[model samples]
Target: MTPKIVIFDWDGTLIDSVDHIADSLHLAATELGFPALERDAYKDIIGLGIIEALQTLYPGLAMDEIQAIREGYGRYFFSKQTTPQNVFAGISELLAELAGANAQLAVATGKSRRGLARALESSGLGAHFAVTRCADETRSKPDPAMLMEIVEHFGIEPGEAVMIGDTIYDMDMAQRIGMPAIGVEWGVHPRARLEEFAPAAVASDMAALRQALYLA
Candidate 1:
């Protein structure tokens, strides 16, 4: 069946911003007098929002400290690194193919609404997505609320849309809503880690992701 709409995960799926994220997290942690997260540890927190990520990283910290760290991370991430985020190779081509196929597009991300908007505008992908649901619009990843919001906003059913992302949160949220998910391997999370969510299919690269989306 043809997909009526396509929902994308912003950060690691379409944009290669893991390095920026790690940098911000590291800077924030250091500023807060906490240990910087190791690379592997950062990978494990890819899909969650900043608040959740901070909680996971410094669970022993007091609530106020956690809030402060989250605030610091947000400020640095948006002001310092967002503009430098580059789109993954072939992602633009794939998105073009999907758009040419008349598939409505949207974004569901753990990023804040303002941050996602800035990233898209800076990256020249703002016009491509008809709707964008960020952390401020709904609960964080794995909640299914954002995905559900996207579906409703676009007037499409779960089965009529596919959620494409690079993390388990994306896959599991799609599963919860009975939507097919196309998992990409080159993002923050590795293939082995993504497989735990039982995605409908896994794509090793943008070319393969196009095929999974029935655009190739």
Candidate 2:
């Protein structure tokens, strides 16, 4: 059966913002005199919330220092560019097609509320999602709370909704909630890692993702 509601992850899934995220983290670590995260380790944390990211990387930092790091990362990310950057090709078309097909699109992201809002506004994607839940607002990805909230808000059962994202966090969360998920190549985690979560499809590209979601 076709899904009535579709949940999407931001950052590497829909936009090519992994560089920005890694860069910002490096900047924050340098500014705070903490060790910078390695590229692979950094990529692994892409779908996690900022606080959680910091905690995992620097597990013993003081609370104030963690907050400072968070602030510093935000400064680096937004200051370097005039606006959000690096949306993947065909993303707008995919969302538009999904919308045209009467899909109720929602966003379940690891981005904080402020970060999600900034990206949505800068990317001009706010109108596409009928509802959004961020990690800051609920449990982070892999926990299923965010997905359940979106489904509950829309009054749809888990079976009627599907998640389209590019990370294990997204896939695991959907699985825990008994929702089907479609994985895409345009994300931080490797395709093999994403496949370990058993998504409905590990789409090789945006066009394939569109076909899987709209045609399959």
Candidate 3:
């Protein structure tokens, strides 16, 4: 863990929220008269914000219609759903180990701040992250806003920080910002899809992830 500063993506990397996200998204899409997204569609459109994901799902939709869909989705996501979340297996142990090693941890996610905060508090993982960059706090992934903001917050060089996530968007963000990326196979995206982004390394699980970081 020589880098010390590690930023993680939340949804598929640390917590398993795919089923919930898919269900919610399906509901929203149906209400908007759009086709339901399959698992592969979900995997493809993830890492972007809800609006962006909806745009990807329905490319020909008008701006006003898209806004309406976004509003409907947000209402459903906040009021009717509980995020359908569960921490991944071995994540708690891994976080504990990272903390014990005196490494600096943070979160840079596309989730809204309130949503991310509630999820973290509910999962008992809030204390593990020193800083969190949410959708409201920065531009979305591929922009490097979250990564650069977190690096500045930690007073560390971007090269000394590692971005851990399951999507190519995370790898692209890290690369754009001059940080190494650790792609995880356990996430929503396929390993081959992630490799398309040319990540610094790929980890099959938390234990292997630790070893990769150790070598770095």
Candidate 4:
């Protein structure tokens, strides 16, 4: 059955911003005199909240160090250019198709409120979403808090909603709350990794994703 509400993850799933994000994190860490890991290392933490990502990347970080890295990351991230072109090809059409089918669209992202706002504005995709929840506003992914809130906001049961994302965090959160999840291969995590979370389906591209959502 087609879900009434479809919640999307912002960075890797909707837009092609993973490389840019990884770059920003590397620059930030390097600026702070911390050794930056490979791009894949940063990519692994893409769906987590900033603080959580930082903690995971550099465990045992002092509070002050975390704050410093956060500031540095923000500076580098915003300094880069972003446009509607960054949105994955066919995403706009896919979103429109979902809305046309009477499915409510929303965003559940690891980005901060300000960061998401900027991306939404720049991408011109904000109008497509019925609502959005940022990492800073609630418990991060794999926790189910954000997804639960989105479900409540729409006055629907967890089973009536579906989450679409590129990371295992998205899958784990949905699974924890009895919501179906669809994973995209184009995102940070590999198909095998996402499969471990038992997603309803793992899509390799937009066409496959649409089919997973019953839109095809």
Top candidate on lDDT is: 4
Q: Against the true structure, candidate 2 has what lDDT? A: 0.85
Best by TM-score: 4
lDDT of 1: 0.82
Per-residue lDDT tens digits for candidate 3, residues 88-189, read 887877877777777889999888787888888878888899999986677877789989999999888999889999988898889887798999998778
TM-score winner, 2 or 3 = 2
The C-alpha local distance difference test score for the whole of candidate 4 amounts to 0.94
Per-residue lDDT tens digits of candidate 4, residues 1-216? 568999999999999999999999999999889986978899999999999999999999999999999999999999975798998999999999999999999999999999999999999899999999999999988899999999999999999999999999999999999999999999899999999989999999999999999988
Candidate 2, run of 10 with poorest lDDT: 80-89
- lDDT (C-alpha) at residue 144 in model 3: 92
lDDT of 3 at 206: 77
- Number of clashes in model 1? 0
lDDT of 2 by residue, 174-205 (tens): 88878999998877877898888888888998
Better by lDDT, candidate 2 or 1: 2
Report how far residue 183 has shifted in candidate 3, in Å.
Answer: 0.4
Candidate lDDT scores, in order, read 0.82, 0.85, 0.80, 0.94
Q: How accurate is candidate 3 locally (lDDT)?
A: 0.80
Q: Using TM-score as the measure, name the better of candidate 1 and candidate 2.
A: 2
lDDT by residue (189-211, candidate 1, tens digit) is 77887788888789998778777
